[model samples]
Target chain A: MSSRREILDLLRENARYTTEDIARQTDFSVEEVAAAIEDFEEAGIVRGYQAVVDWGAVETEDERVRATVELNVALDRETNYGDIADRIAKFPEVTSLRLVSGDYDFDLEVEGDSMREVSHFISDKIAPIPEITQTVTHYIMESYKEQGMEFGDRDDDDRLSVSP
Target chain B: MTFEPADRVDQVPPSGIRRFFELAEEMDDIISLGVGEPDFTAPWAAREAAIASLERGRTSYTANRGKRELRERIARFEADKHELPYDPDEEILVTAGASEGLDLAFRALMNPGDAIAVVQPSYVSYVPDAIFAGAAVVDVPTRSEDEFKLTRDVLESSGAAEADALVYCYPNNPTGATMTGDELAEVAAFCREHDLVVFADEIYADLTYEHEHTSIATLPGMRERTIVFNGFSKAFAMTGFRLGYAMGPPEAIEAMNRIHQYTMLSAPTTAQYAAIEALDSCWEEVQEMTSQYDRRRKYVLSRFEDMGIDCFEAAGAFYAFPKCPWDDADEFAEALLQEEGVAVVPGSAFGEGGSGHLRVSYATGLPDLKEAMSRMESFLE
Candidate 1:
């Protein structure tokens, strides 16, 4: 990818980069940097900054169970994967769905209140479709880091009062 | 209000750099490339330590030489990082920052009328501070033709051999020139031959780009004669926290403490504790910042070269000393600021032989550096 595209992708992860920092990495003129960022924002090419939430933080409260399901599907001129993929995306429990390469054509990240519920949703609701040829589901055992945040050690309150 | 310093203090010509800053303050759109401090915040680990200290009510005054535990940490840190060996209990005096440490060292070492040999194109404080300490300054110009190196030839030709002491800043300010251990061993040998004491400011030691920074004190027979001044300002980005230390022979440290205890009783107690944490765990942060600085340094130097400007390629520190294509730095700098709204310090602010150059700092982030370079491109053309 071009550096500008990479810059936007990096921005998606962290917006703390000053224009000077970006210009250095991107080999762009600092004079034109602010305008470029402004263009990105004004044209809705860039949206807003956000925190990447770790579902594990609130996992206990919701009894959240997440599973990654990989599927190999039949493809030809008569039908396309996008047709069924879009339909599968409408399910509220599916957090993310991507058309991947290799043996599996699609991978769906699904969440549910329990493993039994997720099992039921995948087996009873998704597999009965005509397009599906094979299915595989894997449950996440642990998350050491999520969305660029490290969670190895428990975090403590960091704020302190100022003393003169 | 009585506003009077010792009459001698009034004569320490104010920094020419400050004058350029006056113009910068008046302009709202100025893109500056003239800060000496790092653009990064203190790392989270270091800040976390300070917060922890404050929570424990660590706001009281520390020892005159700072907390013993901190001193030990400083000793270990220096030993581990630079192969410097000093007795922490007797040899380290933690000051407010390198600024205060420099002041203390000067006041402690200089007798009235003593001469201090200082390199030209040096830090602004060196000449003025030496003057304030009631010492005569022997200016030895380090030339761009010679890569801004203060060689034994420059020292001898300038009659600096007769001076009572010498000050050297490696990974130098304004120029960013650094020396190898072999080169410094030769200089250290010269200092020994002349019976000159050395104040080696290694504040920029952690920011060296392509080379390993060699501390002069590490050379044979030099440790006893050299006081290495370093702190948390540049390395750990703890400038406002005001943590610094001086390490040397026990007598020199004691001499400095005599003056230090009377003037400034202690460095910030909380900062002392925080610095202990910094010395222990902030190496990764320092490495990260140094890498960022190294990248910026390469880009800035490449841009200067691409412009066909003659620049001394500095392997250490975060400054680019580039010759201005003009008659004098002050006029050229003023014109650039007025015409392009870019602010940089005139090299003349440094010292003699600095007239045709400008000091551009890469301590600022890259975009500002890029903007400054682009503006200078048009300004120079």
Candidate 2:
């Protein structure tokens, strides 16, 4: 089996396993496992690896919340819009910025302490740009599917190929 | 709406300061003073508290504003330290950091075409943030002779009283400059007369060397209009922990908190718990650290003087903004980094009036600072 397939099978069974552990289990060298991981990363197939520390075990606090910012840009000021988007993208507070359609010109994912901080970005940072005319910010109260979790029991007998 | 091809988007210019820091990060064997991050870890007690919270399974979404205990502790801290009384329930808010607090203030208070006054050579975030809020930022330039302290004359001359809000940061970033009680009073008086909302960023207040940190809200009549931003990042070396708080009028706090509630939901729960312990158990450690910073500040100043590089004695914070011996601060900083493995941020990265100056943080240990000074001297020679 290709290294990619082997890694994927290991991850599918245990997404939280360390690279070294995965390599050992899959009978691959650590460097090979690392290379396979990098390939997965480059292909955008494997976005990231996170330690899924149980919220219950780590702390009984509420789960982390996510917020989205909808930005409205001017049609005539295309150059200015890109400039604005690029600038917004660079902010440490902003997680992602995507050019979108409908009433808004773009959608942004902002991570911060509270909605006030997010609205401040929308009002004080995002909306005030010469290119940005309007903005509507939505705070995510909860997430049913976050970081893309797949549901269902794994088929132990079937060999699955992982594409990079 | 389906748009015309010409109406797509544009990319903005890179933040000059951020760009410089990124470059500094790439170089091997670089002794960087480029970053504004605090050097020390979040106090061990604070970190331990956070870990304890994690062990206790306290990781859930907190109240939108923050945990009640954290807010209450912040209120107590402010009152005891600065004589600013705030109601934890209505007048105080916990934020990701002072950065977010400033952003929230601008969003809550500013409207398009409204003007805001900022002290020049201030933190880079103020200008961009004000601009983003649709407010025209009027820069009030402070001079080296004045120790870069914001004065009533400069504030009035800049037409800050006419602005929708006045954004002030003391024990300021980059410069390590602070305002005296009288100076703050004068500005407060002026703002009161002009009906200007005062957004005070006092993140570095606890790091003052010469005197105690005083809040504008401490002045009579000022508390009603002043919104103070402070956090644990600097004094407690909790930058990575990302905990801060804002205090202001009930109405204004409510507005900002509403936005915060809708957007952030709450600050990290574990961090908030840790912050409570930080405020409660960490004053002695803070004093010790501040004393050490003062010593470093003196050493760095003497080094600048020895090098014939004019620098004002910083009375607060851990940065020394020294006049560069060269004409262009950017070029000088680059040369220092490339030739001597020393990294300092160009003053221009902060704002206008910052050219020909460099901000060198003394957050590193005494030995490293001594070595950097030696490297700097050799490079200059």
Name the best candidate (by DockQ).
1
What's the TM-score of every candidate structure? 0.75, 0.68
| Per-model CA lDDT versus the true structure | 0.83, 0.79
| Lowest summed lDDT window (length 10), candidate 1 chain A | A155-164
Model 2 Cα lDDT, one tens digit per residue, B274-354: 899999998888886876677567668866877899998788988999989999889998888888988888888877678
lDDT of 2 by residue, A1-164 (tens): 23468577556545765665555334466798888878988998888666533222336354444578777776563476577677889888888899877777789998766666766766777777777777777887644444444223322311111000
Candidate DockQ values, in order, are 0.07, 0.01
Identify the candidate with maximal TM-score.
Answer: 1
Off by over 4 Å in 1: A1-164, B1-3
**Candidate 1 lDDT by residue in tens digits, B150-179:** 788888888888998999788888888988
- The 10 consecutive residues of candidate 1 chain B with the worst lDDT sum are B28-37
Model 2 chain A lowest lDDT segment of ten: A155-164
